[model samples]
Target: MKKLLSIKNIIISIAALLLVWEILFLCSSYSKALFPSPLMAFYALIEMIRSGTLLSNIGTSMYRFAAGYFSAVAAAVILGLILGRLPKVFQYINPVVQLLRPISPTAWMPFVVLLFGIGDIPAIVIIFIAAFFPVLLSTVSAVGNIDPIYLKVAKNFEISGSAATWKVIFPAVFPQIANGIHLALGTAWIFLVAGEMVGAQSGLGYQIIDARNNIRADILLATIFVIGVIGILLDSLLKSAEKRILKLWGLK
Candidate 1:
């Protein structure tokens, strides 16, 4: 009942916000060309949905996002595990990692474009960069921060090598790693759109640019709304997955 009420409140809040937006739009002096009303944006969204352009753009974005995000997660987790197990290796790479970590994924656009040219490749590469560091750092921290007693207990139980690492270390640190993944997911989505804006000819970001070029504020606003909705859905999906995993691991 509490959960249902919470969801009801959320719906009510959203409706209230939309009402406020409509009121503001009615009062504002900005032309419809410059600032579209929510109703106009909703009409544009319906048009896009009917035309199939919205689905196509979303599909393209998802393809690029999945490819980049999964690869980054795999690579980062493996490297993080290795580095976490070997402090010397981490120390040796720490300087280079730190130097590169601070660089924004958007800042890499010029180099990425020059290297990969104008297409999905550059966008995927940018997403990978956006997703990698957070997971890597978080995994490393989680592993390194594990209580010493757990390590001793594993050793005492004759749990050694890969078995120990997977059964003990991974389970213990999963929450922290999940937190990192959640953070990276949001970051990757942001960079994916920004990357697509500069590199790809399709996807939500490209549509925004196309809408602006064509002087369609309604379409632009609708695309932005879709992006926000997709972002929320993505986070919600991750949260659900995290909860399931935690339950399986007896951490929930």
Candidate 2:
């Protein structure tokens, strides 16, 4: 029943969006070429799919996203785990993290491009930078705040060293770390497109640029819609995975 309700809600939301879009298109004075109706964008989306442009760009974007995001999260979580055990060390490192965290990933595009050149690497680097700090900070904070009773239980069981950290601390703090991972996923995905727009020759972001240069507003809008839909799908997938993991660990 809940799943059915969720599906119904999604359908209604999408229908409402289309209605609003059509209303705006009808009311606007702008030419159809400049501000396309939902139907026009839908047709454009079909054309791109038929041409295999959408799939190819999606594959490329996903490849970069997976490479960068997973690597960043792994590195950050590992470091966070280590630093989290050392509050004194983390205290010193937190200042530097705070300083860098506020800077937009795109702000480093020129420098990233200069170092890595125009290709997948720059986008990957941008995603890494975008995802790194959030997970790191969250993991560290979570670890530091783990319940003393959990550690006491581990000690009572003679769990020590890596075993204690992994079996006890890691699972205990995972609920919090998961929050960071969730946050990073969105940040990384957004930066991936932004990075691709400037540094990549191909991908969804570049498709927008390509469409704009050709004055194909329909295709541009279609690409934007596709990006948004993909983002939603990714977020949903992550949420499901998080739920499953928590269930497995009996943490949910």
Q: Rate the local accuracy (lDDT) of all candidates.
A: 0.92, 0.95
Cα lDDT tens digits, model 1, 160-244, are 9889888888888888899999999999999999999999899988999999999999999999989989999999999999999
lDDT of 2 by residue, 1-252 (tens): 999999999999999999999999999999999999999999999999999999999999999999999999999999998999999998898999999999999999999999989999999999999999999999999999999999899999999988988998999999999999999999999999999999999998889989999999999999999999899999999999999999988877
Which portions of model 1 miss their true places by more than 4 Å? 156-159
Among all windows of ten consecutive residues in candidate 2, which has the lowest summed lDDT?
160-169
Error of 2 at 128 (Å): 0.9
TM-scores of the candidates in the order shown: 0.94, 0.96
Clashes of 2: 0
CA deviation > 4 Å runs, candidate 2: none
| The best candidate in terms of TM-score | 2
